[model samples]
Target: MTCFGPRQQTAALQQAVPKTRVQTCNSTPVRADGEFVLYWMIAFRRTEWNFSLQRAVEWAVELRKPLVIFEPLRVGYRWASDRFHRFVVDGMADNASRIAAMKNRGVVYFPYVEPERGSGNGLLAALAERACVVVTDDFPSFFLPQMVAATATRLPVKLEQVDANGLLPLRATDRVFTTAFSFRSYLQQELPPHLAQFPQSNPLARIQLPAMKTLPGTITRRWKPVSKELLLGDVAELAAFSIDHSVGVVDQRGGATAARQRLQQFLERRLAHYSETANEPDEEARSGLSPYLHFGHISPHELFHELTSCECWSPARLARKSNGKREGWWGMSTGAETWLDQFVTWRELGYNMASHRDDYERYESLPDWARATLDKHARDRREHVYSLDEFSAASTRDPLWNAAQTQLLREGRIHNYMRMLWGKKILEWTASPRDALDVMIELNNRYALDGRNPNSYSGIFWCLGRYDRPWGPERHIVGTVRYMSSANTARKFSVDGYLSCYGEGTHR
Candidate 1:
């Protein structure tokens, strides 16, 4: 088995860092005499098991400078709400605690939660004024690409953006994949060489630090460190921030600590049954790690490394075809193979698309066949059409659809099986295909903690046939674009169980 623990640094896992994974967003030369190496933390928020964090540590060592991690939670982003803010703050609190524990080693972290709109962004540029270099997470989705480009231009020092979003670097593929089969084929051939090339999951496990003085009182006063009360997981204080509070936080906790705990439990308990029962709405075999992955509290590389280290599968055994098999490659139990497909290939497919295409989230970005089919049925008579507000309230006539939406509203996520049906019903009931897209985006973004991610758009678009192909018996409105039915989906799973768990009265 490949050794990925802190002690064993074999040639396989210690390969030279790939240049494709790192990019210099600014032309500015690195500052020779500066206060510290600034890690402008954004998407990937974890202290350890982070590629971008590892890059920052290397730069700090090379420059003989102390490292200061700057993380911010802004109130002004699209679909910002109490739930989103609370989840982020909880993670930040976890980060604050971990960083405090590392203070003896001279690593410092400061998280800024904006009390008002436009309060947090200026702090990064302000901190950059004294930094030798600015390194950040190179996530290529939503406003991140544009935000990083703009920040790089304005910062006085060198700005390096590192891709820590997935097992495969976003730049690895040049073209957007049309389907999972094609992407998996590319993945099968490409994964061997890169298997041992994971970033240092715990950079601090090896680094020795130089003690540095604290920042000036003026800067600290202007942008104070997050309070212990906030760090203690107080949502009431967070809700007082100038963001929407209607969408409340879920009962679930958020942080690297929480993520690590969840990962451990899933591996030990649910992994064996993962493939056998992951799609069953009535079963509890899920990892529940999506929100953590979405928030960058956990790393996909970390997940991949832990799984690979198990020695559960060998290359010889994995030679079997994964093309159409429910299980892919890896000689491990059906669970492990199925999980690797979901956690790596499917997740990264969306990241790959977002990295290559600016229109990844746009309605017009749907495939030619999908668009033509949707356009062909644009004028088809609709039996039911509901506005976005009605959908949000879960007042629909269909029990199954209402259950899915309420699941999203109450739990901040829907079961994986029901999520597809949720989108399919929305598409069927909306006035037009475009209207369906808009409503799906709005509801997902506002409610789900895992929303506003590359996968979110991928999942939503999949319902509209983005990465899917035509099916038999083209139906109304959807045309050749694939279709799903409540009655049909209900028969496949325990509909009564699902309805009770997430349907009407469950919410009330």
Candidate 2:
């Protein structure tokens, strides 16, 4: 490997990551004598549209070293289950195939699946010892932030984390907007430049570096790369691992392949009706891309590109002023505008909060008014109180709530509108507001494929009025915070097919 001086390394890094999207986790310098540049694929797992991978490629080319992509799955993380494991391994399988096809590109993809608790410990440090530098994903929510911070301090080489979470960089603004309207206003003013600076659509194709032929024997012998058989085999094999097999895999496959397919399906068949029918429980207007986004199998930039290309949209089409209105800002069709609101404003709102506040997921993180209102009605009599066990078992007296829970249990997801009613009902049925929050978090993170993500926290917190204003006519158990009812939900939308599809009897 060719050695690069500090100034050369710095210049390469600057070219690789934008100032707004890059962060040095530790003070260490890149190792000039090291064998390869390691791309630790944490949040952004796909080969395409990834800033972290692009950064690694840049470092590798600059230093004349091969690139090593390490994507690992630990069995010890909270809520690790057959469902998440299978979904992630499916992606690993896809990545393995993709990288194999690019063998001439001088990249090595290593996917490691921990067979038991704590089995994969120290693997990253081992890889870092031989790497010129480590480039990884910069994600704010869940265990990723802490994990990266801890790993950076222990590694021998410099560690750089790149923000590829969304269209707007995580560090773009320090202020956390309280509502979607406010976030939309901020984005309308600040997001245009970011729209123009997307990660390379196919970064691997452009990567030109020496191929890493082998891994160190010590690291390879102990923490072996996951087998092709395991990745492509029946998900039933996941039971052998020390993870929760109770949360089984859903019907949907995971990875960039499936994510793109779902995106195309939504664009061709459902996007036009998205504005009108997205809230209807029986309609297939919702884009089923949350799981893919959560797992980093797809990039928001890629989705944005596809959408913009379809509409012939560009930064020049953006509104001249920020009025906090959702539809006009994008200068796209009504459906595209509506979808962009959810995709950019609402989804990135969670990222904004998580990036700014360490307590984003805590019950204490609720807005002052929401907490005050919820606390005021804490002791008010509840019509019914259900234990976590009963809730998890989908034995609630409310058929609609049971259906939602059943859907979550069976499919790892719920209808968009039904999920709101689901959380609100949980709040209504639980003993206290805090208890309600606890139940929602437990149920959601345990089953939903998209759980433990910033967006997931946003949705869960929204139930307790995190990003909402107080409603009028204070009510018992919910107080001034918004209230939802099964009867009213029934009146608002036809859930007959939803009920039949995920009714209590269908629960396993």
Candidate 3:
């Protein structure tokens, strides 16, 4: 196995600094300064196995100063919703509870209610009065990139980001991946050496500082309180918002406990069929851990540790290999291997583009051929153009697309394959390729549990050929961009079953 030496160094630094993984600025906090640490909880919300959080812990321990975590959620951020808010509120509740255990280790939890709170001013900045540095989640795409860019310039203290989403931070990949195969090849060559060791936290035992004060009694009492105004809001008001509300706030649970349980369930039951059924929309075979992953409720390191801890691989044993070359252990099922590839290699590919490329979220950021094809097809005849409002309302005539939208509405997510088709249809039915891309992003970010994610951005771009190649003769609507039809999808998969489950012919 080719050693990902630099990656190993990055991992070590991440563990040592704790904030390195999530820090966007890439500078290490100056520990000798005796400044307290600020854990700017953004993308990665969980407290455990968080490189950013750990980095704060490191600073606290070294400087004998307090550590404070600030998590602010602003309203009107595109698809901000009750569902998303509830998930985050629950996570804040979780953080409050967990941080209580750390005592004087100093942790603060802030859950902002947007407009009412007014973009919630800087508790982090105030905390930085004595802060050694500020560390936040290192997300490439999404609104976060803009947030961090602005933050890096504004923060008086040094700003760093630690990546806790993908198994390997997207920046670890040297070049933008053109396809899954190329990305997969690189991951296969790199994962073994670096994936073996996980980041370890700086134990609390050494930091026997004063007990940290808990959240103010008022904040604790008001935690996740019901919103009477929201309950009273008109249906049209609710509908106008992009955020998903179908999965009631109660259904959208968050926090580390829920994230961990979800991961376990996937590995124990669903993983066995991952290879065979993950693509079957009706199966709902995916791990369902994505939202947690997206929210940083569970760490990638924690997930990998669980996988490696299973000594007796469920359903079999790995065959012993005598070859000098390092190969996968025998007895590992295809399902296990396949899912790992998605989790580590393919998913990381999205991160790679997001981190390295400025236009990662734009149509122009797609591969050269993809961009050319989309430009060529920009003026092609679109059979049925729909406005963003029409698409958001699920008013499109195509039942498959409607069904997919319904699934997204009710479940707070869509299945993986259906998700692909969802974006493709947006591309096909919109007046121009760019319009399709915009609609795809708007809709996906608004409803999907995994919306507003790097993957979602990459998925939308993929419909325009980000990680794919040219195929066949250029066609209208899609140009050289890949074409996917409801008919073709129907032929390949059982769309009827999915539609039936959500109730066909019902335009609600």
Candidate 4:
């Protein structure tokens, strides 16, 4: 490996970068002599519409070093299985092609799949050893923050993290909001200035590489990438790994290509009818993009910019004023407005909460009011109590409840509207609120493709009254923590239709 001297950039290029987007991880000295700028692509998997990738390119250009994207997946996360592994490998399969194309343009892409447990443990540190500066995604939840923290402790050169996860910068809010209204108000007031600076969505568009065409011989000899055949739909690889095998692969494929296809399908066919049928379990009309968003196959900014501004549409068409209301600002169709709220306010709100609190997922972290109410009703009796096994097997008494759980078991996700009822009922049936929380986390994190996301914690904790208010006429077991009745929920939509789809073979 040889060092490339620090390169100079024009004022225009420097000004294009946003200061708010970058967060310095360590104060270690930036190397004046190192092989290349390294990007450890953990969360944001795509090549385009990625702030982290863009920032890496900027650093590589400014330092006159080739960009090295080192992405490795260890088959040892808590719930690693054929299902999750397949989705990720599918995305990597896409990334492999994208990286191969960039090879001609001086971007060195190394995709590694851990052959066994603990194989990829020291990957980032090894890459950082020879690099000028290491840059990675600033994801706050799951094992990502922990992984980056571990790497930051040992790296000698500078390490930087870019928040490419959400529209709201996690650092902007000092505290988490307890409600959607409050966050939306803060969002409306704060987001205007930052919106003007978008990420270099297509990092490959402008080809500016270091003079060197080849990577460090040491890197090539020691860290050769796995075969492309292994990157694509290789479920058989899971058998060699030490993780759960019962939970199976999902039918929906994973990758940037698949994500874009899903997004286009959503915009073209479903966006028009979204507002009306989004919550209806029978219709299956929502964007169907959460899995992609959670895994970083796609980005919120990409989807948001696309939704707000297309050839036929613009945010200016938004007739509704930013009055701190949930909908209307986009002055677009009902579907777009409804989705924008979910995409920006709600999704980012969860991201904001997780980024600030280390114990964001804990039961004790629930709002004071919620904790009080649940404590008040802690001794209340339950008419039905089921173990975690019953829930996982989808053997609950309620047909709707069983159907939702079955959907999770089979499809790796539950429909959004049914998902709420799924949590609320689990609250009702579990012997204790603490037990309910544990159950939700296990079932979700183990099965749902989008389970490890901030939204997953948000939805789970929301069931126990996080980001919510006490309702009138406090009910038993749940008390004032907002009760949802299964019967009432069943009547809200086509219950029979839901039962017909996920309820097959399993008894109600």
- The lDDT per prediction is 0.83, 0.87, 0.67, 0.81
lDDT of 4 by residue, 225-340 (tens): 66565675667766766667898887889999999998988888888888888888844498889999998999887787667543245334544445788776655677887888
| TM-score of every candidate | 0.96, 0.96, 0.83, 0.93
> Regarding TM-score, does 1 or 4 come out ahead?
1
lDDT of candidate 2 over 429-488, digit per residue (tens): 999989999899999999999999998889999999988998989998888889999999
Weakest 10 consecutive residues of candidate 2 by summed lDDT: 1-10
How far residue 434's Cα lies from its native spot in candidate 1, in Å, is 0.4
Roughly what TM-score does model 2 have, to 2 decimal places?
0.96
Which is the winner by TM-score between candidate 2 and candidate 3? 2
lDDT tens per residue, model 3, 405-507:
8777777787788888888888888888788888888778777767777788778888888777787877776776678888999888877778877645554
- How far in Å is the alpha carbon of 84 misplaced in model 4? 1.2
> How high is the lDDT of residue 252 in model 1?
88
Winner on TM-score (1 vs 3): 1
Off by over 4 Å in 4: 1-15, 211-224, 311-321, 504-508
